[model samples]
Target: MSELSPYEIAFLSGGPTRVAQTALLALYESDRIRVSRGTHRVEVLPREPEDLHPVQAAVIDQVPGTGRLLGAVLEAVAAAPEVRAVADALVSGGLLRAGLRGALRPTGEGKALRRGFETSPGEGDVLRLAALGPEGVQDAKMREILSTDDPKPVKMPKKPKGGHRDLDSSGLSDTQYSAGL
Candidate 1:
């Protein structure tokens, strides 16, 4: 099999989430996208490259004008039709199989590609390390995204118990009702 692209390697190593995360890392590194620290919001910059992969483009499109949360962007991209197309293509090419727990199992060719990538990764493959599931990633930016960049949790107000006021507080009692018709 021919050498696989970083996207292919990322999918083989992990799954759609990894693909999305790797694509985001690439875009971030290339200045195609901007990730807000602390809040983890993502926004597509103007003058985006025209040669982006479908998955990368999808990620950009997924972000709204106001920007989206990092975790939301990752989830959106992972489930996007473009990313699914990549998985479908790989499966059609006999390089991947659907394994237990929705995991992607690589075929022989896929295995060889992964072996090659792990053995001698190409330049700028450091961003792809996040696709490998947080291990072997040394880049500060990549590690920051993987470790600290997540959507901030919404702070919901606590609900009152029993959902009603006390019956004793009412002026009337159950026994006080008239039974006469």
Candidate 2:
């Protein structure tokens, strides 16, 4: 298989939330971008002959005041500058396309990506491993298997027979899923 581009990795790893979750990580994955981390904030530093997508670079350029770091930006609301910029970048950069006229009009690319993230095993390995964080992997073997920036192949520890995903919280079956939708 061919290698994943940084943008592709970010989209498959999660989505807008995943990109937002580690803005710096996602941004810095591209050779054109660098991150300057302060005690409480970060700056999105761009390199000359920028290798980033036009949309991504443009959004980074518009991020105000050295970009307010990763943590704060991730926790910020939709209207916040960074969140707004990232959302725009996601669509313009082709990770997600614009929806139709309505407020909830789903875009074609967005729907396909969402389905892959939720249902494609080949695509969801990193996502599931990410969900099962370091704390979730109590065993050294699992931890060793999961610790990597770009995992080429992964051998996930088999789920227990009873279907409890982890010990931290009660695992919910399909019927028990929240929101009662």
Candidate 3:
């Protein structure tokens, strides 16, 4: 499998311009990798493995949840300024295409560049919540799950035995009942 250089990886990760610049600088310093910036695409030659920078790792970590928006990726990376710079750099390098909503999405080349940063959730990572029945109904199963050994007594309002009615008729208008006086 062909590997991606640090610069390529940074550009693909998608962040502010400054962050991409820093990543590119780091990649340039390393001899194992080569970079090609063009209007059509940014290509990385002779990709090599290197320790991931903290910023890159953060962005990668957050990508799964916030891949839809550049701003979301910035929030994940917690680098506001860097996110903007990286976004500009990626667009300039042809690593990403600008969308109608001012968001950046990975191009074909960009996907290949981010292979090393992929991650998956591990086993036993269950999300626990109160199980609800259909339409938020408190079904028997839900009730069983929620019921405790010492359940609190539910206080129900007492209803009038003879139904609601005014005991005193002092304010009654003759026209109200239309009864013969």
Considering every candidate listed, which one attains the maximal TM-score?
Answer: 1
Kindly list the per-residue Cα lDDT of model 1 for residues 39-66, writing each as its tens digit: 8889988883579888888988899889
lDDT of 1: 0.75
lDDT of 3 by residue, 30-117 (tens): 4422222211111233445557655444444443421223333334444544455545666677668877897778778766544434
lDDT of each: 0.75, 0.42, 0.39
Steric clashes per prediction: 0, 1, 10
By TM-score, is 1 or 2 better? 1
RMSD after CA superposition, every candidate = 13.1, 17.5, 23.9
TM-scores for every candidate against the unseen true structure: 0.73, 0.34, 0.27
Pairs that collide in candidate 3 are 15-83, 16-82, 16-83, 16-84, 16-85, 16-86, 17-84, 17-85, 17-86, 18-85
| Cα distance off (Å), candidate 3, residue 154 | 31
Candidate 3 residue 134 Cα shift, in angstroms, is 35
Error of 3 at 103 (Å): 1.0
lDDT of 2: 0.42
lDDT of 2 by residue, 71-142 (tens): 344444223454445455555655555446522222566555555544542322233332323223343433
lDDT for position 39 in model 3: 13
